[model samples]
Target: MTSNSLFDNTETAFKLKSDSELERAYFLFKMISKEPLVKIGTAVTKFALNINLPVEGLIRSTVFDHFCGGVNEKDCMSTVDKLFDAGVASVLDFSVEGKEEDEQFDSTAEKVIELTKFAKNKEAMPFSVFKPTGFGRFKIWQKITENQHLTDAEKLEWKRIEDRYDLVSKEAHDSNIRLLIDGEESWMQDAADSLCEKMMEKYNTERPIVFNTLQCYRWDRLEYLKELHQRAKNKGYKLGFKIVRGAYMEKENERAAEKGYKTPICESKKATDDNFNEIMKYIMDNLNDIELFIGTHNESSNYLAMDLMKEKGISRSDDRVWFGQLFGMSDHITFNLGAEGYNVAKYIPFGPVKDVMPYLIRRAEENTSVAGQTSRELTLLKKEKERRKL
Candidate 1:
């Protein structure tokens, strides 16, 4: 199929969405398309939940139901099955965030382990994911990255975090499931990158079971990738990475400005896009040694990957290369790619309605900030609706 037409099959895209679901998706995108509404809604929702104002039901019915798979892994099975039916797989992401306690970190680690076991033999669920901060305090990671000396107690805390990474990575390796380690803000990312590299050294000796994330919006990431690629080759271990245009551009630049350091982010949107495509091409070139899980919502980037695959004589269903999008958004890319015999997975975030609010809020904010993302969703939903009506 031509790159121009690859993602245009709305019928295939929305075939899995019932009329009601389609309408709800359209309405959600319509709401997300407005910046003022998103800002207001986020504040109001946070306030309501903070004051114990029974809004969970309201949230569970609308944004939560649309954006998340369910409140837990068990609750996500139906969505997993449905996506699998459409030839797309699911990556169960326990999207709870912002915990600092070791107990909470252990709990999150257990949850990831359980999800890995849950995905063990399941064809529908190919991978599991977790954030770095989900298993450790953000400050601790930042301290490590900044080369600040940690207190003796802090040394113990860091050990626990490393243990959690090893525990989860070992479980994923044992279960024969791929684990995606999500990238976070730049300050904490170096430590996380080191830990993930350690995991890759351990679990990826035979193959890529532990995957690190590369936020391609950063100007230095291509260089970092090249350095890592050379290291992996020298070390004789496979490398796996999930590359994205990144989610924290504004916060990244703000912190860099406040701290009087040069921003690591690309100068402009076009620069970030160019960087993303370049990183994808670099990974595509070295696919033999590096497995890639492309986590993107950009049509042009996806089309570029498709074209590159065709040019390289890579099989359409190559196991080393997979495409990913979040569950609620980008159905056109996910489902259409799946229909065309590509390996596609949706990152299905799941947690309690209250706990998942931060992630949901971020999603809404992201939709508003990302130029034309929500509008593209609206366009596709509207086109599918019109076609169905006809």
Candidate 2:
């Protein structure tokens, strides 16, 4: 494997964006960098939408354009094409959030299945993803997790959620496209884990057609992954997982504090970072039986994984090891890694702007809390602009 500076080349990284687009990205990040401004902006954006204001144009041109692929699956193909041209893969994530009706849940399930069919036989688009909470009520999931006996109607509702999972998994299995089930809060994860485990048992016996996400910020996820690994071995199935530092820190911490429970989150960022790297090392060490998709923006951890692959004498082009970052946030990691002949992909989420506002808000909040996330992006854009003499 070639040992290149993973993030030093701005040209290859920003080649996908033209000067105008790059400038827009810089301006957007600049706005996001002001912490108080972002908080105010988030509140105002939500209020405007609630009163049926015409803010979709503003949102669609800025954050939505940067973060999401488009308003629909067909609309995402242009992005899929561009990334594929650059040798990067696409995981088409249906980004619609906060749906609760039975009809809405069924529609979300069918949308996932349709994406699987669309991605079938497409080398550029290999994976389809969805969040369980998007398809079912969160309270139901929490109740199921607590093993509380459900009323007859709640039992039926739970069955509907399980049926949706079965349909989504079956479609992916039939289409031979991998499916990633996004993880949620700790209270609801056990139910998600159970449904995903059932899919893995049925579809993963042949290969890894289904994957469950592991959020490493949770203190218990490392042990959870270990138990899953042991179960995979005993059941004679390959374990597939997408690991991340996690996305729900504030909500988790706030809820734990409100409920007077010990937080499931790691005490410090360093602890979460340490846990993430350790889990990645474990996966690489057991690469023969496990497939790993690393979803992180941390440059050091990315390099650490590359070094581990080299140390283990694993080929950089190995199929089992893949890297992922969000569509418009971590172009440096995605494009540079793709340029280096490693398997890399962007999590390209698409949905109507109004429907995806919850996701957009979370992304904004994440940038605010991630300490220099926006500034880092702004710095890279400035460097590229300078390189281009713009």
Candidate 3:
């Protein structure tokens, strides 16, 4: 397909939405475009939910519907079917957050395994994902990061975390479902990365059944990718990777400031973007041993990957490469890429209103903070709506 035939076709992008739904998106994006409003709204919504106020309905109809799949696995099926019909795939992400108990971790692991099983033999659902922090204790990760000694009881607790990872990855391998380990705060990422590498060694020998996320916004990650590549080469296993600019920029900078250490994050968006694109190129050059999932909303990076694929004579249907955007937020990129026969999927997060609020708030804040992201979304929606007019 021609380059022009790609993402500019907003009509194909929003074809899944009804006219009223498109209008609702227009209004929502317009509202979120205001930085001050988003800040106040996020704080107020969190406070309201914490106080047991009845704001679920308002949230469910607006941002929640626009950004997430649904309130549960069952509720997400219609969305899965819709995207599949449009030639896009689905990655069901259980987006519940902020828990620290052993039982909670075990439950999260089970839910991840259940999602992987649900995806088995299902064409629409190609992959399932979970955050390591969701199933591993944050304090354990912190202590390990700081080189602090653990007591026997704490050692036993760490054993349980390892067991949970083994259970989930074993299920994914047995079920033939691809599993992505979501990236988290920098402090906790070393433990997660090690666990992901261990799983990749176990499950990704013949094919990539496990993926570790690389957050390119962190200045060290490009060098880190080089290290991971060397390890994969030495171990003789295919490396599965998901690349993103990252999520915890503000937190990372704040912590670095408070601790009087140089920040790990790139100093500017340009540096991050450049690092991300360079990583994309590096992975493309090593496609023989790397399976890549390009996860971003940036148009330039998306196009750069597409161009790399074409230049390398990689087929659009190549299973080793995929482009992913969050559901409902980047329909133009997701659906148009799908229309062109490129492997594409959405990160369709699902959970109850209260449980999913943190994810929702992040989406809101990200849109507001990212330069021109909200305005760009609004522009595309308006273009599509105008095109549909007689």
Most TM-score-accurate candidate: 1
Clash numbers, per candidate: 0, 0, 0
Off by over 4 Å in 3: 1-5
What clash pairs does model 3 have? none
Error of 3 at 169 (Å): 0.7
Candidate 2 residue lDDT tens string, 60-95: 988899899999988988889999999899999888
Q: For model 3, how does the per-residue alpha-carbon lDDT over 1-390 read when each residue is reduced to its tens digit?
A: 247446678889999999999999999999899889998998999999999998899999988988888999999999899889999999999898988788988888999988988999899988889988898778888887777999999999888888988899899889988888889888888878887899899888988889899999998988988898899889988888999999889999999999999999998999999999999999999988988999999988998888889989999999999999998788989998998899999999999889898888888888887888888889999998989994
Clashes of 1: 0
Q: How does candidate 3 score on lDDT?
A: 0.89
lDDT accuracy of residue 227 in candidate 2: 95
**Candidate 2, residue 265: how far the Cα is off, in Å:** 0.7
Q: For model 2, what is the error of residue 372's alpha carbon versus the real structure, in angstroms, after optimal superposition?
A: 2.5
**Model 1 regions lying over 4 Å from their true place:** none
Query: After best superposition, candidate 3 residue 349: deviation in angstroms?
Result: 0.7
- TM-score, prediction 3: 0.97
